[model samples]
Target: MRKDLFNLGPVFGYFFRKNDPNRPTNFNLRTMHFINKLSLAMFLVGFLVLLYRWFIR
Candidate 1:
């Protein structure tokens, strides 16, 4: 958490740079996209594992 914030500092800086206000800048957009995909994958994997366990029981 704290480490993530530290890592995201430069990312947020670039995200807030001038010339882009309405949408996230390129770096921020890419970072967010990657994070979203990763989280979704993790959620699906966990859900599948839970479903398998429930069916077995």
Candidate 2:
């Protein structure tokens, strides 16, 4: 949505930034939001699992 994000492409786009109006809608905004949240959830879960393993063994 912002000018800065346009240069970063889909990596930042996955973090809930809306697609710029001039760009194509094939990616769809809602899907981006879902992916962002899912990614964050997985990242947190993975971090916790690693932390648990680090301390448990």
TM-score (all chains, Cα) for each model = 0.53, 0.51
Off by over 4 Å in 1: 1-25
- What are the RMSD figures for all models against the true structure? 8.7, 8.0
Q: State model 2's lDDT.
A: 0.75
Sliding window of 10 residues with minimal summed lDDT for model 2: 10-19
Q: Give a tens-digit lDDT track for model 1, residues 1-57.
A: 465655756655553555546665688877886787678678879999999999987
Tens digits of per-residue lDDT, candidate 2, 1-57, equal: 688756756664656576578865555765786787898879989999999999987
Clashing pairs in 2: none
Of the candidates shown, which would achieve the greatest lDDT relative to the real structure? 2
